[model samples]
Target: MAGSLPPLLLVGCGQMGGAMLAGWLADGLAPSVILDRHRDDIPAPHSVVRQASDLPDDFAPALIILATKPQKAAEILPSIAHFARHAPILSVMAGKTVGGLTAALAEAGTPGATVIRAMPNTPSAVGQGMTVCFAPPTATEADRALCTRLLSAVGDVAWVADEAQMDAVTAVSGSGPAYVFLLAELMEQAGIAQGLPADLARRIARRTVSGAGALMEQSGIDAAELRRRVTSPGGTTQQALEVLMAPQAWPATMEQAIAAATRRARELAS
Candidate 1:
């Protein structure tokens, strides 16, 4: 609750959108209205208009949060085209530039709509997310600040001056969850290959990743410090680190993966 947050409007209520809604509700933000083609997932006691075509004439939302898939933005825009001309638009669609959103909003009639585009990671579902955003050049400073505060309701939000950096942001945070999940999967498989019981392998992998993450979060120290603390000269941990960080190793592989994702993001934007 940033004191004077706009009357909320949620466009897509999928996982990311649902997580945001949960955060808002937990923070006691009862949106003026919510819209989603599907409505089975939201909690009880919500007031949703449900359809764009049937929008109530008297209703006016101060901020419209577009949380739909990047590919679906065009399809979703016309549904709320009327709001494009009035409300400041806050978007969380990856690879979508601010100018593109403004154009969409202009087509909907909100020629001067203040637009903010953001790339948010999956951790927002638990308030541990990393989010980056960029505002249109025409956006007023006050509007940008309001957008930041609005996004902060869910998790950590940082502003980006360059919209071109958004694809890199998408590669880093937007695709980061999947990368971590893949690491967990590979860790479990490795444990199983080491002859541990399947159940034990799964359990150990889950706990190790979770505990390491928790320690990193709880401690104010940097991750490098924590990693060094676990390493000892000529010890087992050192041996593992050597293999993982060597010239031809996981770090390089991860960089390649990130680059590939970055390229794909650029392609999507194009």
Candidate 2:
């Protein structure tokens, strides 16, 4: 299968897992198995089972994706620990450390399992995701490359040397989509307040946000430079920027928001 991914054993098929699976399927995936209780929409050649107990005896996966909820690790890891001996585990569970997952697998009879962690956002559903991964020293370069290849099917990928940075990454990119959506919401409401028709307001607000994002991606220009290019000395955009860019406005608010999100991410770590 030229240009196809290797076999995968996906342990969960919730939002994040399903998003990645969609990208993989669109890009030509090898035969794979998805272990999920409630999903039956997977096409032929890719099997879906209700539980780990139903997994085939002779199936071998090159990579095992752990996309289950972080709290479910204790119950799930032990059941799948045997696979760890043969494949590196890539976990998309938030706040679960590589050390903690490795310890869990070891306790379940699979010692020295290679574990990698990643933070990916909801945009992955649309194949525009930004995922940041952290691989511990025990994981080989091949393990890292495998993760990159699978994740790149969805969107961009990057690596961080220090696991501690993952908290900030979660704050900035993992949770960043909500912040952008909020901007669109506010913009739409403001337009309505200005007496624009509700439907027109909604369309313009959403399009403006999405169009700006596309321009940012395709132009390859710095965001600040783009902002400068749009702002004239005494134009309407400048008038709005004057208020929004106040010392205690978006600048300070965004800093505080990111710091709070980062703090919460660290607090959630197991």
lDDT of 2 at 134: 100
lDDT of 1 at 150: 64
In lDDT terms, which candidate is top? Answer: 2
Q: lDDT for model 2, please.
A: 0.92
| Cα lDDT listed for each candidate | 0.79, 0.92
Tens-place lDDT digits, model 1, residues 189-220: 99999899999999988888888888998887
Which ranges in model 1 have alpha carbons more than 4 Å from their true place? 1-6
Candidate 2: regions farther than 4 A off: 1-3
TM-score (C-alpha, index-matched) for candidate 2: 0.95
User: Where does candidate 1 clash, by residue pair?
Assistant: 85-110
Give the distance in Å from residue 224's predicted Cα in candidate 1 to where it truly belongs.
1.9
